[model samples]
Target: MSAESPGRRLGLRGRVMLTFALGAALVLLLLAVSVFTISRGYLLDQRERSAQRLASADADFVKRRLAAPNADPRAALMALDPAADTILLLLRHGEWISADGNPPPAPPTPSLLAEVAAGATTLEPVTVGELPYLVVGVPLGDGDAFFEFTPIIELRSTIQVLGTVLAACALAATVGAALLGLWASRRVLHPLRSLAGTAASIAGGNLDSRLPEDNDRDLNTIVTSFNSMVDSLQRRIERERQFVGDVTHELRTPLTTLVTSVEVMHRHAAELPDRPRRALELVGSELDHLRRMLDDLLTLARTDAGLHHDDEEPLRLVDLLDHVLAGQAATPVDADTDGPVLGRKLALVRAFTNLVDNAERHGRGLARVGLHAHGDHVLVEIDDHGPGVEPAERERIFERFATGRTARGSSAGTGLGLALVAETIAAHGGTVHCTDAPGGGARFVVALPLDNTPEDTIE
Candidate 1:
C-alpha cells in the first residue's frame, strides 16, 4: 500500500514535527556532503604544495653538496636530511640514482629522468597499495635528479573521523528540530483549543460563554469576530421569542370572548336564526385556530428554553407506529421493523405522532413505517404518498410556522408539527431529515443511538 497521507492520518503535532524533521535532515545531509567534498580537495592540495616546497629545497641542498670537490654526494645528502623517511635521486650521465631510500633494479627510462631533471614540473596525486600519496618530480644540477613522496594516511584518517562526527551531529540536529517543532505547534494551538471549547459551550446552550482575548493581532481579531457573531445570534433569537410571546398573549383575550359567545349562542340555537347560529359556528372554528396557535407558540418557547425532558427507555418502534396508524381513518400503514431502538419514550412518541399527523394532513396518506439498525444507530423512516417537498424548501419547511400548504388555499394546520418533531428528536440526541421515499413522495427518517442489551430491548 502507498504511504498514508500525512494530512489525513497524522495529528497536527505529528504532521508538523515530521515535516520539519525530514526537511532539516535533508538540508543537513546536503550541507555535510558539500563541506566534506570541498574540504577533502583543499586538504590534499595544501599537502601537495607543502611537499613540493620541501622537496625542491632539499634537492637544491643535495646539488650544492655534490658541487663541492671531493665531497661524497650521498654523505652530503644524508647530512642535509633534517627530517626522517626521505629520498634523494641524482641524475648523472643520463642514468637515475637514489640515496637514503630503496629503488627498483631498473630506474625510470632516460627520457623520463631527463624530463624530471630538466625541471619539467609534475604534481599529481597517486595511490599505491591502497595508501594515498603525493608525488612531485624535480630537476637537479646537469642531469641530477630528486623525487619526493609524502604519505597522506594521517590526513585521510582525520577527514574520515571529522565526517563521521558531522554525520552524527546532523542526525542529532534533526531530532532536536523535530522536538522543537512539536513544542512550538502545541504552544501555537493552545489558543485555538480554548476557542473551540468556548464555541462548543455556546452550542450546548450556554450563550454567555465567550472566547478568551489574547494580545496576538490575529487571535484578537478572531475573538472579536466570534463574540460579534454570538451577539447577533442571541439578539435575533430573543426578538423571535418575544414576537411569539406577544402574539400568544394578544390572542388569548379574543379567544376567551369568542368561546364564551359561541357557548351562549349554541345553548339558544332554537331562538337564534340559522344565519346567527352559523356565525356562532364560525366563531367556534376560529377559537380552535387560536388555541392551536397558542399551543404552537408555547411549544416553540419550551424548545428554545431547552425544557424538553429525556427519559430514555426501550421503545418498540413498529408497535408504536401500528398503534398510531390504527387511529387514523385511512388504510393502516405498513409497520415493519427488524429491531427496537433506544430513546425517550414519551418524546419519541410525540415526535412520531406529529410526523404521522403531518403526512395525514398534507400527503395522500401514510404509505409505510419501517425500522432497522444502521451501524451503531437505529433508523426509523415514515414514508408518505404526497407531493414530495421541493428540494430547496425541505429544510426551510421545518422552521416554526413554516407550512407546506400555500397561503391561498391549504389545509388548516398550526404549522408547528414538523418543527416539534425536529425539536423533540434533537432533545433525544437523535437526528431527523427528509428525503424522497423509495416508492414515491416524501420520507422522514429519525436516527437514534442503538442499545441491544436485554434490558434495552423493546418487548
Candidate 2:
C-alpha cells in the first residue's frame, strides 16, 4: 500500500483548529494595530497641544518683561517659569539662550530658528540624546522667539504598555479560537464516526446494524439514506442465499439417484469394456465432487439464514478427533487431552472433517493432531507437513472461494471446505486460525470454550 502524504495526514479537527487560529490571529493583529495607531495619535496630539499652550503663555510673559523700560533680555528670559522636565530656549539676534540652568545638548537647527523668525509658529517632535521631547516655538514681536522642550517619556511608556496588552489579548484570542475549533469539530464529526462504526459492523456480517435516529436535518437525511441502502443490500443477499439453498435442496434427490446408479455400474464393471469402465469411474468421481459442493452450499445458506440445528451436548474433544482421524486413511500422531465442549456433535464432526480434508489436499498430509485445554478453552491443533501459508493470505484463505498458492498435490479443492469449517466453529463461539507449525509447516488451531458444567448431556 502507498503511504499517506504527511501534509494530508492531519485530521479534520486539527486542520479546523489551525484555520480558526490563523483567522483569529489575523483579525486580532489588525484590531491591535488600529487601536495602537489611533491611541498613539490621540496621545501625541494632546501632548503637543498642551505644550503649545504652555509655550505661548511663557512667550507672552517674556515679551511683556522685555517691553519694560529697564528690561534686560537675559533677565526677562529668566523670569518665565520652567518646569523640571521642560527646557525654555529664547532666540534673539540669531543667538539661542536658555531660560533654565541646564542647556540642551545641541542648539535648535537653523532651519527651525529661521521658520520661527519669519512670523510662523512651529510645533514638532524631536529627540535629544536618548530622551524624546516635544518642541514648540512661538515668534515674539521684534525679532525674538520662545521655544519649549517637554520630555515625553511617560507617553512612550503608556504606549509600550498598550502594545504589550494588545499582544497578550491576541495570544489569548488565538488560544480560545483553537479550543472552540476543537469543540465544533467534535460536534460535527460525531455522526460521521457513528456511521463509520455501523458500516464496519455491517461489513463484519451484521446485516442488522443501523444508525440511530438524529434530530439534525442533514444527519437525519444521511442516516435515512444509509439505512435504506443497508436494507436493500441485506434483502438482495438473503434472496441469493435462499436461491442457492432451494436449488441445492431440489438437486439432492436427483444427485443421490445418479450416485446410486453409478455405484451399480461400478459393481457390474466386469461386463463393460475398458473405456466404458474408465468413463463410469470419472462420472462417479465428478458426481461425488459435485455432491460435496452442493452440501457445502446448503450448509452455508442455512448458516446465513440463522437456521442452526444445534443439539448441544458435552463432547470429549480428544475422542471426537480420534474418531475423525481414524476415518481418514492417513492417521496423524494424535494426543489424548481432556476437555469437554458444549456443541452439536454432527456439526463438529463435519467441521473437523473439512479441516482434515483441506489439510490433505492443500498440505502434503496431516503430520499431527492434538487436543489440549488452556484455561476455559479447548484447543485442537492440526499440523500439516507442507508449505506454510503466508501471513497475509492466512485469514483470506478462510473466506469463501478464496484460494491461495499452496501445494494441492493433484487434488483441486472446491474452496468451500475451510469456509464451512470457520462458519461451524464460529456458530459454537469458537475461533480457528492458521499459523506456522514446528518443522516448517502450517498448523490449524481451533479454540472452543470449554463447558465443565456437571449437567452436561446430549440434547
For TM-score, the strongest prediction is 2
Q: Which candidate is the best by lDDT?
A: 2
Per the 3 Å backbone cut-off, how many clashing residue pairs does candidate 1 have? 3
The CA lDDT at 414 in model 2 is: 65
Model 2: runs farther than 4 Å from truth? 1-7, 72-84, 92-96, 261-280, 311-352, 368-382, 387-409, 422-459
Q: Which runs of model 1 end up more than 4 angstroms from their true locations?
A: 1-42, 53-93, 96-123, 127-132, 153-168, 204-243, 246-250, 263-286, 309-323, 329-344, 404-411, 451-459
Tens digits of per-residue lDDT for model 2, 34-107: 99999999998998888888888988898888888978767877787677777777777766677654555656
Candidate 1 local lDDT, 21-63, one digit each (tens): 9999999999999998899889877888898898788777777
**Ten contiguous residues with the weakest lDDT in model 1:** 403-412
Go through the candidates in order and give the C-alpha RMSD of each one to the true structure: 6.0, 4.9
- Cα lDDT for residue 281, model 1? 80
TM-score of each: 0.72, 0.79
